[model samples]
Target chain A: MKLSDLLETAREDAPAARYTVDDVVAAGRRRKRRRNTGWAIAALLAVFAVIGLPQLIARPAAPPATPPPPKAGPFDLLFSSYRSGDLRVGDPEWVSLTNQLASIGREVSPGVYRSVGRLVLYPAGSVPQTFWMSHPKEPAGAINGHEASFMPLGRSALIKADTLLTWRNADGSMVLMASFENRLSREEMVRLATAFRTTSPRPARLPFAISWVPSTMRLVAVDVSRPEAATALVTPDRPDIGFELEPLYEQAQFVSAWSEPGLNSAPQPIGLSFPRSTPGNASAPSGGIVIGVQRSFVSGTGPTPKCAPWSGQHNVRQCVAAPDASSNLVARAGHDVPQADLERVAAAGRIVGTPGDPEAWPTARESFPASAWVER
Target chain B: MSDKEAEFREFVGGQMEALRGLAYLTCGDWQLAEDAVLGALARLYGKWGRVENPQAYARSAVVRAAIDETRRPWWRREQSHGDAMPDIVARDEILNIDDRVHLRQALLRVPVKHRAVLVLRFLEGLSVPQTAAALRCPEGTVKAYTSRGLDTLRRILGADLSIDERLEARHEAV
Candidate 1:
């Protein structure tokens, strides 16, 4: 066969595309928005450096407010179910564990979930939709006499190799064991894979509740580090204005987008009393609204419950600081929605449980608006 | 859909498959190839009207994206559950499937850069200058890579595929 014919044949049996054209358009809009936002931030920083910083420096420095009592770290709830002190949940160094972008794994044991790196557990049977890159599989000998294999979990330009071992548990659930920093050898990985077991599915919970969202928006994706961290991306049904709905998630330092597949279609019904038009959002279309809510870990001395316009070029955003300043709720809309309405939605953000107690936290269904719950 | 969106959809419909094939040849992984195409096409969608030659831009972008996919952190790589052989050509072949599979395996053994050059020149049938433009490398580098890539393939297949000498001489004299 001609080399060209062989090349054509190689791509002949590709699986059906997992994403739709609309998803592509939506992602493009988001990328464009992110680029625009990055430029805007750069410009704002330049202005701040040129004009804003000098005035601040020239002013008398106020004494730092007495620090509020140290609060629980954002990931405290992730370890809520584990009664044992043996498993360290979130260490300063483990921050790399949360950067998988979109990864999910099942709970292997109580307080011991096996996700990308962090032990944060995902609901059983959930699979990642977008595998960011292709991993070429290689053979690793059997583990515990059951068929087993391992794949290098590093990028093409790998510096420290990570390996992922997979084997079938007698219970039929696949057990995935990953090594971090190349610390575990092939034998150690196999041993862990052989020993690990997955427990029955447990629902993930959140530390905060969003009692309201704009009527038109729906929950699309969620990134949660159980017990302490959670963020959800909620946008309208329209695909055309996805750029206007780009996540302001970066506002919260801990959370990232859950790139899980099929999560986008999991929209819950939203009950509505919100008007179609609001004062500051006159130009914002109802279909262009996006709302993001995150459990805040930053401690500030500012007065409770402040709402102000957030940044964006084509959208109006209102970031409402929770009463305890323990969570951040940001509402965004195309240039048409009234800013007051967006504020009202953001201000509805409520901390539903003690920051350090995972058992006290609400399940996603309980915490999110009726429309934002993603049924597993 | 607006006129711009309609135009983009039409372009995607026409070129998506060809782009996928090109990316697969470049990256040697179907999943990664699809990802590269999707990403490149999405970027194309963002610049739909502004890009003067969408076809060329997409071809270059898909190849570049596919290469980048190989460089991404392993943590971001997909985890397959099965113990399948490496590079299992998808299961739709009928005629000379073994030959195609062997050629593909041999082609992958060529270094990624040289392999990219070979695919563009021989498979995509681009001239040395065109391949260099697509790869953002100099013409001489393209020529050298093409020669090195063909030599490697000849060694692996042990087949005298001297047909490219004429093509190379013609381009070298230009």
Candidate 2:
């Protein structure tokens, strides 16, 4: 009984600790209020726009006496597939391409060639949808991986200026194989697949359309002019303009694994809001670009930003559509900075001047494609 | 003061240190235990009129809060807990400060729920029923946890230390 009494004394003698209930409660209240404010702002914007005059609405377009037929292209359908992070010589990287490109899962560029096509094996497995390069010649299947595993087929040439390998997609588009052979592998095919998987694409800024080629490794063609400029896409010869290359993310400060697997991220900043036009016309879509900083497990993958801020235009500014790829030919009102500054911003990741073959660089000029430039 | 508020103040004054002790055993860090208890008490104050027995309610709240903190974030762990076994002694040795501190460090490494049961059974002098009431568990659970906690404590602290030595270390710390 005496021992029991003493135990109570120890229990009751411990000192009480301190904390703020108000702070926790206050944080909760702040979160609730922020949600409420968001709803209120959305409602106010809706009401204000609704109350605006009929002057805000634009009239319909005058119908043409004879509508023109849809224009066909002199363009190559460029498909993009990549492996991100440290894809040692035998791993898989996720690959995504413009809907036009299909991963037929086999070495052959499907349908383009009859059964006489070359057979290629991919570490992503031998699926039938893995087709990319254009075919009509000798049977050759080229397998590569980047942000994910890919099984493309092609022949490649190395840029005499650098070790960057250039390959042709089965479809004749250009691709550059990034050199990230940091790990050892017993399987030759797996080693080749992994070498492809660890590569990253070039800087694809907004006001530009980046198309992929698999012939060489890590090459991208930028179309600042879109659809119409598709005809002006960069090729091995006959460049339409003189341009340069810049590097936004230096090659040394990169890791490949962080952007791998599902590439699952919280609300990606790279967004393409489809453009809107009047009832019959195409939509005029606009969006913002953010400076991207990519961290991964390899060296080849580099930084590419979307919609980086343009000088003087607090917001909306039109990208010029030059019929010919040479220099900026269009200008608009309310733009604060010179077109030259806008040109420099567009050149943010380029290396400048001709360093190698015109095919080695995705731009038509073999330096920087004027077709991909935006002006102030 | 209204009767409910006055009753709450008196009840809190009575249970404050005991609840703090329970929290300390759960979290091992005196500071975090204090925060857990104080937060629990303030919430108790808001429910002063409705609670049936504020002490038990607050004790349960402190235990739950301390456990949650242990799982989700840091609760100021004793760096020594992982390296050296907590100090414990045979029933024959004289209780000392060094032994008490080492024992407390080792006790902190035990599972928080297990430590709480040990504190309630031995440190608080709760009968099986009282400990169950405070923990909002059945008396059978209290007994099982008490047995398991003692076994784990003995295994962790070394077989030389007996229940009496642990009680004496508590006395030395006080």
Worst 10 residues of 2 chain B by lDDT: B73-82
Q: What does DockQ give for each predicted structure?
A: 0.24, 0.08
Q: Please give the lDDT score at residue B14 for candidate 2.
A: 71
lDDT of 2 by residue, A1-376 (tens): 2323322433443443453444434443465567679989988888767775343554236655555423311122222343223222211111111111111111123212111111122211112231132223322244452222223333233111111222333322333232222111223323333344212223222222222221211212222212111111222222332212211111210122122312222222112111211111111112111111111111222232122333433443423322113222221212333344333333343222222222333433232334422221
Each candidate: fraction of true contacts kept?
A: 0.45, 0.15
Candidate achieving the largest TM-score: 1
The residue-level lDDT of candidate 1 at A175 comes to 39
**Superposition error at A31 for model 1 (Å):** 1.5
